[model samples]
Target: MATPDFVLDLRAKIGTDPLWLCGVTAVVVKGEQVLMVKRADNGAWTPVTGIVDPGEHPATAAIRETLEEAGIVAQVSRLARVGVTGMVTYDNGDQTQYVDLTWRLEWRSGHPHPADGENTEARWFDARSLPSLSDDMARRVGAALLPHGEAEF
Candidate 1:
């Protein structure tokens, strides 16, 4: 995973101290297909995700991430899931937890492509025949398919 510059700066000051951060993921749906990205770091398929920039709304971050990472323009239909989704310790000893705010986004334009180095591949998958996803990804996708409502926590 590419560490954000702000995070790298904090790491320089705090060493391996744990940091809690807000992040956003986009469950981008176009008809029966959902967009997924193959991560450069782990090669696992996941939704377009990124850290919420300081002072940015999670929904805005979700839209930005989807465009930046997968070259897809989308509009948030509703908040899908909001909870702690990533609690990880990197091989370098850096530890972090992400409060993942996921959104159900409707694809508005553009095809899937890896627009950034964070992902190696980006493609749309049949919602019913998706590649293996972590429990967290599965939960978010399920929530996104539900009728619009208040953000889940």
Candidate 2:
């Protein structure tokens, strides 16, 4: 994934010091299937995820990321989960953490593909038989699968 210009600027100033940022996870559902992406960096199968741009609404970020990363259009159904992630140290040694907003989305249109270089594959999987996901990612999907109501915090 390309680093956002704003983050690059911040990194220039702070080096590897941990920075707090906002992120979004889009768990798009089409009936019993869920959209997923195979990340290029780690080959992890996960729901469409991205950094929320400065000043962008988290729900809108979820929609934008789904289209950009997975070549699928989706509409946010509701906020699913809000949680903070543990610090992440990237390959380049840039350390950061995120307050993630997970959104439950409904498929709108478009075929699934890896539209962006961030992922090597983008496709839908049966929700009951999805590839293994990290515990955190699994939690995001689980939260989204719940009946619509207050977001999990």
C-alpha lDDT score of every prediction, in listed order: 0.90, 0.94
Give per-residue CA lDDT, model 1, range 33-114, as digits (tens): 9999999999999989899988888899999999999999999999888889556899999999999888999999998999
Would you estimate the TM-scores of all the predictions?
A: 0.95, 0.98
RMSD of each: 1.1, 0.7
Off by more than 4 A, model 2: none
List model 2 lDDT by residue over 1-153, tens digit each.
889999999999999999999999999999999999999999999999999999999899999999999889899999999999999999899999999999999999999999989999999999999999999999999999875888999
Q: Model 1 reaches what TM-score against the true structure?
A: 0.95
Please list all clashing residue pairs in model 2, or write none if there are none: none
Superposed Cα deviation of residue 116, candidate 1 (Å): 0.6
Which parts of model 1 have CA positions greater than 4 angstroms off? none
